[model samples]
Target: MTQTLVKAPFRADQVGSLLRPESLKKAKNEYKAGKITAEQLHEVERQEIKRAVDKQIEAGLQVVTEGEFGRDWWHSTFMEHLLGAEGYIPEQGYNFSNQETDPYDVRLVDKVAYNPNHPFFQQAKELVEIVGDRAVVKFTIPSPNQFFHPNIINGQYKDFEEFAPDIIQAYKETIHEFYRIGIRYLQLDDVYLAVIATADFPPEEKKYLAELAVRVVNGVLEGKPEDLTVTTHVCRGNYRSDYSFSGGYDTVAPIVFANEKVDGFFLEYDDERSGSFEPLKYIPKGGPRVVLGLVTSKTGQLEDKEAIKARVQEATKYVPLEQLCLSPQCGFASTHHGNILTEEEQWEKLRFVVETANEIWE
Candidate 1:
């Protein structure tokens, strides 16, 4: 495997999706209400994305994303755009802490394929053009395993065996298209695998689920460009500052650490809910690195520099310091509604990650 030497998934990084500015938020709402033209919405998105990219650079981040401002939520937005999929706003919503979200869900209306003119591809292209070598432009998408959830998969295929190949091919084609468009850094935001890891099930069942997740991910990564830095972010589900699952990497570590073919693992470890660093021992001495998320995005309060340092030191006990990096537990805004913090607070948290990373890795 050839390593891509980009300053991303670096000693300092994030899980993409930043809080949408008020202007962008308003424009999105207006477009939804049919008050604004698609052309008008596109113009606003372009300007806002440019500003978001500039903010990443200003904050001392070497890697940047479009901040996912073009979409309302992470997973469904991308899924709905797939060639064979159609989305719907359900009457009810999923629960998370004190909140419930009226999420849009996707169903396969036909066989899936990459639509070259998909809005996300166009948006990613624009992001690459705007960054213009100023920083490494990163694009994030939901992992293929994510679509395997019963909510998405049940009606589409007879079983995993039947569904896997089509989705895997779609993702492979998508990755190749992304590479063709000058995208060298890509992150797969996969919250489902982490959720599966935390579930209480028969040992055999857990192992089976874990293995299937790894299989689909590795399949999606098949034949990827050696110079492309493909990483997976295992989210425990971040919506309105609440999580859907909680557990250590222990259950899935052995499977993912040993089996998955990727460049790095962006593992969440911001609080006690995620459990211990013991699973890091499964990581091989070399190859994929670990980007530890010790900072919190759920709240705006700055973490003590000394405390974070202590955690980094503790993590070094499992994985060598050279193979480690830092980030917030998750994105500040996994959805466009934004997290429960002020914009200034969001920047402060990210800036702190940069400052803390510099102190340790400098």
Candidate 2:
């Protein structure tokens, strides 16, 4: 069989389609309304997390994540939770492509400061203990590059170039911290890497950013144990019923695919927005494997089984079938408010992935 989802479950308050029963929602509403303390919200999350973990294992997934349960948003949740991060509410253009975006520039409060007290760092160390065996515990962190990616400095950057030094340092430390905590399957969520690779940026500029991303991420892996399984997920975007950046992997191509310092590449190929499978050839013929996100997490609709099989077959033309795997194009949800899909609908979609894999590989 091909590769399986290294981590398949979601966490409580995770950025996916899993639900927290109405009771917890009602409690959260009360908490937000000033009737309860933060402790109440924490209490609910703790209880709900256990239930989410149980449900994931029951579904037969072997690699389970906390579903980013404690995180608020997917990309920058870890940033805000960091010690020195503060919001830089901007008075400017939108950060994403969708118009429904709420305008408020929430930039990192600090330019640089690595406080050693990140909750996810500590939480991940304990996550495996709570995950309850039979599945490899997995965790997703923003790519080191994104941590220091200079954004619109008044609509551009003081210098996207200036971000390089700090990006390297910050990511190096962040990665080691996870390794120290005993993390094994670490998935670096890298949207920006693919974005710059495909954008109209100058060739030198794109190469610089790609090289820097690899430098920082790989630098973090410099002295790691061989057992570490590092994977990267190149998502277009997943927000509150919104999509972020969009472009085919064709833009990034073999550069981002071959450059990332990882064991696998989770490429989003759910729809036309993801482009064709020809780019799969850019992936080094015998390097890391590719997890084809043939199943999509954007909606509840399951993929046609025969069609997905055919697509997978087509992909083997570029990369060997044995080197391929399956998964939802992106996280079912990448924010506290997940995409508009029922929980049952989400399960059916995942069931399709598992069933499809069973037929194709087993």
Candidate 3:
């Protein structure tokens, strides 16, 4: 009894960012070295994005993204583009499982506000023009909760109470701006929720953080247009195939599943670090549809088709099959560095999701 969704969170969706093609990577480096102009770099991005969209459709995906090809880091690019936020080289980079990332982070210099002229607006316009009507165009941004990261230097606001509303207003305005354009599918890529979910904290402290996470998310989502298919992709961190946190969703599931005001959830469940599906029971009937990230994007290895199907069947114990969809654990490239997998392998993985989903849901 699979229910067909005309909106997004498609049966076979993706977590947005894709592997950066070598040409675009080279162009980025050339621009950095002043060998190529910004205009030239953008032209290459446009070309690569077109090719990426075509491949996504060719792989049988109904939704297409620009592959987050226009920037260096997935979250920082969008965040720094805000009116009052700026990028800075931190003392250190984020610590992933066995490695450290490049030192890049965002900081607020003044009161944060949405910029109508943000580069993302132009990026979304180009994406819609390139995608045409063949597939839905999905635009992704970091969640407001992401701003609460300890690394992000906050210079304007004093406390959560003073800070939360402005972030909420900024996000609400940004969403409306996207809606004004042709984007109907918008996703907030959230790693903070997962960070708090698995962080070592006392029971009461964890509960407070989880509740605060929901409030920030819902505040940003308040009064969003009905036509916008807003979803949140929860990740435990996806950088160079390295992860940041590990633990079950057992503690935060009840809070997130029952409250976050979103159309669906792109949840990471590719490995044991994500824990069991028992927490999915907290998802009330008729609430957000769960797009299961059962396929791993960390490596080039393709999972057994039957094993993925079996995992989906296992998830059905808590959530009905009709309420479930499929995707990779995270994007192939959450950062411009991309993952350690070949481009061909990324497509192969996506094709597997489409093919496997067809068998189970179609």
Candidate 4:
């Protein structure tokens, strides 16, 4: 039987979030210090995001993000905006590969539910209006599992199962709201699942954790709109270009690829740490498309186009070439501080992805 090809937003896409420009950074700091009003900060963001969107179009990407300028951190911004959540600083940092993150977390203070006026939703609306016909827009949020990170203690529930239902409901409502407001593309940036995937747990323990991750995500995705294109971006970790985990998708592929009801996947494959493309075999002949993260956002070094194409060809051994696309291994700026690369360098990397995809897939 012939396998039908999976259509995606673009042959060349990104994992969302671009490096924050100096102007946006300054405005954010000003707003935080009360030196500028919210209106003033938003004005800056509006202008900066316009520029970012233009840059993405110029790089030949069909789908672009607002660069997540309104966010201080990837997950914290959206989580903190939840109606029942509150933010707090912790005593220790989230240890990563060779570095540690500053302490920050969002706790459940009330019953979990969606906030009608989520700032991220408003930002997505602005981006689509600004982008017009130039390109499609995607808004990314950390997964619901992020709220239950072990480091975070729930203030309202004694156990995760006690509140998983509310969490699922809140996310479902949130997704529906985005669709109602005209958002067709949404990406959930999740490191928790990847962390579980890479951890060296016993076989049974690992499968159990992976299954739990899938259940929570699928719960959030339950009854999603058909027109909505939802995808998940898995990363080992990305904080100021530092990572927390390593290993391949082999362990979690069966759990995620077969269970989670996402339209596609943005997978990390930039370095040796991510293992091989062998696990692509488990993707099921005609399931979700896979976006190869052959380009790295952690550094400014440009990858050879021929090398990237060759790697994509290698991946085709498991999954058909038509089922594959290309993107950066992760966002250039998972946090507002941005990665270790310069803005120009980041643009170069994106341009490379575009050029490589054009040469291979177009």
Candidate 5:
């Protein structure tokens, strides 16, 4: 299939959050220990982000991200920065496969609202300046659905339905602010929907949760600009190469794939844990494109190029080849600890994605 290059969510896209460089990690530790000033730490972050952008372009990726260089946890960093939300240590950490994440989580302390002066705006502006037309700058944040996690302490609202409106309004304003600052491509890193799909809920309960997910997401996208491209990366969890959920998209495919108002779906298909491409049939014809995450970010091993292409071909059984793209299952570093992969291995995996995508789509 001959694919035409469009705006964001390029054929060889990524799920943001790259592995942090040693220098930046050291700076973070120093700042945490009060050995370095906030200004000094930010300086190092700026430098590292610039370098990360250069590497993305060099790796042949059309979309460039700051690698979420300034964040410790991809979701919490942005979530806690909201006007009415704050971070707090939970009683227990999130349990993943043989791993437990830090007990940190975000909660609403009052009515949620977008904070225009959120530091992410400045970070997006800096990324725009650094890229300078060389490639498209894509900004990523956690989905409003993420706030519905059971681990999150909901201090303001009685339930998700009541909490939905405030978060939806907050995200709507936030998206506009991103557009004002020159972010044309925005992706919501979502682990909630995927996690729910794996839950042992009754049929009606599952459907109810799925419908709520669509409502929350579509609400935020109610009146987004025509030019701004928004995509959602449905993740199952990514902490130190450990995952929290395991199941197919069967439960939520019909609801989310058919209703969520987004330009594309960056679905994870790196392993059997994500299930078959059969669920992808729920994606209506000419609807949002499906970016097939054929590469794995949890490990350093590079997949066979031909085998990856074969998997893409296999997915065409449900979705047309023209409507499909390729990327890693998730980000290399979803948190500050980073995945169990060397920096060189991470680049090699990305480069493989670019080369393989070109062979299949170009």
Candidate 6:
């Protein structure tokens, strides 16, 4: 049997809106309705974030985040006040077809006028300072490409090709900005890349998009300190308790593999909807660590360890087994409503990931 490595289990994002407890939201509403100032809103978030960081450490996790404590969901919802993205309100998102929640609307903001001091980055800086040296402080940001992607709010693009350069510049600026802030781990949350990549596109078109994505992503990452570790998390789509785009690595493979800058990849492989492991061949062996999102945070059920091990083996045929890691497919909650699973069930799933990883890799 191939030897496996047991690394600590980590979450892409902890359901922040859920973690803060019901009292916090009530405070937020009271403040919004003429009871509190922005400072109060932030104070509550700060208190909860501290609690969140402590709990993560207790979870037997080494790479802990503030559970994205200040963020409502993913990196998008946090953009409401700054970017003017409509995510602050509850609306029907592109994913979760029939479901609705107090969600933000699609974003149309461009990279040209983007501001770095937005609340998202501002509070993130504070969180890093507070969590100092406790755990790897990670900031998850939306890829610039989301602005031009079809279906998002203000995504006026009829053709994505022309939008490439500005997108690159925007993302490049973002990475540099984050690095300057003393942040080391930047998790680029990309959802559209998984959905739009399809077999129908001509090879040239596919290659062009791939090149653009890799180029812009890497461009933003250029000149970073060697000590930094960049991770990219590819999501099919996680919205108000719903799925968005669905496909496999076959379409984006090798294209995804083409980029070698990111130190780790938190990829979705929780179900067959992600496609077979065959496309994994494209990833350059031993390039970056691969965090196989085998344990799902979407539902209450636990995955079988035996099956997970087999999948890891199958994947090893492409990338080195030593280069692999484990995690949940995506955030337990990309939105405030969170998934259908209870907190206990979520922990059990995470327990399964760590335990299964230990048994296989050790």
Give per-model TM-scores: 0.96, 0.87, 0.98, 0.95, 0.98, 0.84
Report residue 175 deviation for candidate 2 (angstroms). Answer: 2.6
- How well is each residue in 1-362 modelled by candidate 3, as lDDT tens digits? 23267977889899999999999999999999999999999999999999999999999899889999997899999999988899999889999899999999999988889888899999999999999999989999999888885446375877666788888899999988899988999999988888878888898988888898899889887888888899999989989999998988899999998988898998899989999999999988878989999999999999999999999999999999988999998999999999999999999999999899988997
Give the Cα-based TM-score of candidate 1 against the true structure: 0.96
Query: What TM-score would you give candidate 2 relative to the actual structure?
Result: 0.87
lDDT of 3 at 108: 90
What TM-score does model 5 achieve against the real structure?
0.98
Lowest lDDT 10-mer window, candidate 6? Answer: 7-16
Model 5 worst lDDT window (10 residues) = 1-10
> Which regions of candidate 3 fall more than 4 Å away from where they truly are?
1-3
Clashing pairs in model 4, backbone N/Cα/C closer than 3 A: 97-243
Model 2 regions more than 4 Å off: 1-25, 92-98, 103-111, 152-162
lDDT score for residue 16 of model 2: 30
Q: Which residue pairs in candidate 3 collide?
A: none
Alpha-carbon shift of residue 228 in model 5 (angstroms): 0.6
State the lDDT of candidate 6 residue by residue for 267-359, as single tens digits: 888887787777777777767777888877778888787888898888888788777777788877665556777767766765566667666
Off by over 4 Å in 1: 1-7
lDDT head-to-head 1 vs 6, winner: 1
Name the lDDT of candidate 3. 0.90
How many steric clashes between backbone atoms does each model show?
0, 11, 0, 1, 0, 9
CA lDDT of each candidate? Answer: 0.85, 0.68, 0.90, 0.85, 0.90, 0.65
